[model samples]
Target: MTIIRRSLGWCAGGLALALAATLGGTSITTAAPPEADPPAMEPTSATSTPGENYVALQFGVFMHYGLATYVKKRPWDYDPHEVSPLTFAPPAEMDTDQWMQAAASSGAKYVIFTAKHHDGFALWPSDYTDYDVASSSAPDRDIVQEVVDSAREFGLKPVLYYSWLDFYKDGGSDDEGNYHFVASPEYVQFAKNQITELLTEYGDIAGLWLDTAPGKFDSGRLQEIKDHIAAVSPTTAFVPNTHLTEKRGGTRLAPADVLVHEAELEGDLPCDATRPHEQSFLAVQPNSAGWGWWSFASRDTTVTTAQDVMVELMRANSIGGAAAVNASPGPDGKLGLGNVNLLAEVGALRTSPTAYVTIDDMVPPCGGTLTYSGQQTDSDWIHTRGTPTGGGKWFFGTRTHSNTVGATATLTFSGPDITVLFEANPGHGIAEISVDGGPPVAVNTYSATRRQSQPLFERHNLGPGPHTLTVEVTGRKDDASANTFVSLEGFRINASANPTIVPVANVE
Candidate 1:
């Protein structure tokens, strides 16, 4: 959740060098070991818990407006304390109603507003600090209250985001520019007091989205904060953005009511249905100037299309998780017209005919449904075995992979089109896919970094009828790949229908 500016150039040189160093200049690849049985998929009940209710609100809009929005500086580029409080200005035309209207039109069920960011500037007149709205140009207004009221008016639940790494007050950095935060007694009490105000003042909030940089705080302090929240608002779910499976070096926040995948930083993975999960991404990429997170001057022209948002939403829903798309307001305190328009389009597409099938529900050609936690039955796939990784890494903690050349997995289904989801990593190989015995398409499933449940192959407009889709292992790989491995996670179709495909199940 640290908003570091990053380039879009996905070069693998750095990862290659790091991997070589880790393995002493030799490539070492390990396939998932075979599992004794597949796990059964669990169904959620009608009367769900708070966490499940949060997940049922499948799409949300994340508002990241704060002091950094006006300054146009990368969030982590400079010490936040150095920024003057006078720089925090929003025009009188600023309207939270407009923001909530855009969110509602986009079919978002909830809104996550950044009540306080890493700069430690509070949106409300907090009793704990003067570095808040009371000291800003808009001293007469309370931004948090406005947002909460507007969200409720628009029939959307409001969720507040609070960063625990407050750079303006409690956190400091070493000479090398690595930020650190210790949960001192005073700091912990200050956080508790502020949180108490938020929970008690804001009536019926849906949840609190807590964020911190890796290695910032100890577990005991986090538990203390959790205990305080539970005591004050037992109904508000505690969501921690710890990036559980990603290589960020911090202890996982234990006993979280919900987990999050910062999809922009970590690859998109399936959600663990046992607990609610959220996958968040920005509505636009970093501007050409490389400013991070919030919207800047140049960001208006670079918004992601509605189609892109629809794809992201579909992927999130297919995996039993919610999607939180961030749309930062500009310095003028208005959302970009482009983002609003695209979101509306996404709303329209949501009502269209789109279907998703997990691997477990897929009926194989050999007349049995695929199961993740039970004995394997006759299937169209050959030379593939169910391999178990961890739940956070793969669907159902298992994926099917084959290393043999000429291995194939065939599916006969009736649909306008289909997209194959799979695991792409340094060890994966190339695959040749064909539809209805049509032309073969080459797909290279290799990445310097491991990505799970990635949509690697997509086919469209195959005419209306039952068609055979085949995936053949070519036993070839990119030069950087370590081995000839091919893995499958799940599949999605453009239209709704029962298909002879595999279901992607949840992990423990």
Candidate 2:
């Protein structure tokens, strides 16, 4: 049997967490619940806007390949003085076709490769920079061209991830240890030169995923970069993963056609309907490999579970959000078999229908009380060692009121299971949870790893009919962590399933 797949993004007001999938050897389309009203967006000249096409593309792959892959050093930890251009080389048999073919098989609509990471290693030879593939050990290899051409062959869009902060050259005006300020006119010109090359040399591109920390550049500077891209590729969607560390009152200076919230906002799209948001996070292999954002050096045990990817995609679509998952390629310039297998599993899950219910406090029929002394922000809630995930709009404890002991979100629902979705970081505190007014149970939600939309707490096999789960902050911190902060994003209730969740297809 084939299930009618409807775009749940347009369905608003009904905040029911719905899950329906065709079972018994049939095809299904995964679906999730609604959380907020779609935002009013700026219309495009084209009938099918770039934002709409992005939303339709439910999943895409974010691949990393750079100096870090060769040296096996974390992107931020590598010492430029010690590195040599001769050291960077992929295996002789490195094949871009393999990557694109796998992406096609995994049901990905696009492939966004790291054209240049913070390490300042360019995949494509750039006329402005000698620190590129042409100058490296693989002098003749054009990884970017290979990836783009291969993606076209496999019927996938090619996008590039460009880092604004360049560690290779120092910005004369503001010279910091690791920070590169685009505020410097010289640096701005340098960026423009490089960007012009990327936009003009490359054929029609899907988009450019720009990554930069907030305060790195002002609104005017950001607009200049956008203007440069517009002059070259008018229709290419411009997505900036900026404003990661900006506070609530601050404006998202460099707002683009789309926003990428990496490991920050998980459950739903934090931005309203005006601008589309792409939900992204690192797919770490093992629970111990740490956050996979900049650790291309550590490839082992960094794979994300296929189950986690499935739920993440469902949650993204539930709130009119697209999903961009990061999976680092090995040092040999090839994806590992384990990562390939996980992608296949996720691809298969996409074919199967998944109906899930999600409840955000901002939405209707999901009324709840949020009591806390800390500030409430709908963005960048998860902070680890001074760096944040750049996507979260939830209530969290502050430094002044570090003790969130009494903060609570009491949710009422009728279901057999309840899963709490929230961000957990090194400074996070434990929560005291109670069901049906029973004795409170202490659940330690603290994780050294910084992540968003985590299903930290779940209760199953309940007695049905109108249940209340009260999650209260204990105002206590783990001895290892520095502060006693607590955070809450949203929740999901596994209520009655009108249509059962059955696997119709298996991904081999």
lDDT of each: 0.65, 0.59
After superposition, the stretches of candidate 1 with alpha carbons farther than 4 Å from their true spots are 1-48, 171-177, 244-246, 249-251, 285-292, 298-300, 354-508
Q: Compared with the true structure, what per-residue lDDT tens digits does model 1 show for residues 1-508?
A: 1111111111133431111112576444332222211222232243655576786687899988887877687656656545555567888898888888988888889999999887677888776665667666676778899999999999999999987767655533333444454555656667767777787789977788888555665566667666667667766777777774234655466756677888778766442334567879877744442343577652444456665565566555544457888777778788777667766766654543122212332223211123321223323232222443432344323456777777676655544567787788889999888888989999999989887767788887875345667777889999999998888765665423212123433322
Which run of 10 residues does model 1 get worst, by summed lDDT?
Answer: 1-10
Model 2: worst 10 consecutive residues (lDDT sum): 498-507
TM-score, model 1 to reference: 0.61
Top candidate on TM-score is 1
Candidate 2 per-residue lDDT over residues 1-508, each given as its tens digit: 1213321111124432223345686646532222221223333356765655665565788887777777766766764434655567877888788878777776788888888877666788765555667656677888888889998999888888887776664461235545435446665666666666676577867778887656556677677677666665666677777645444345666447677766554333442434566778677656433236533333434356665665555445444456767776776667766667777766665553222222211231221223333333312232222113464323211111124447655665543566676567777788888888999987666778765546678788874436777777787768887666666555555422211121111111
Candidate 2 residues lying further than 4 Å off, grouped into runs, are: 1-45, 172-174, 180-182, 247-249, 264-268, 287-291, 294-303, 354-508
Clash statistics: count for each candidate: 12, 23
Please estimate how well model 2 matches the true structure, expressed as its whole-model Cα lDDT. 0.59
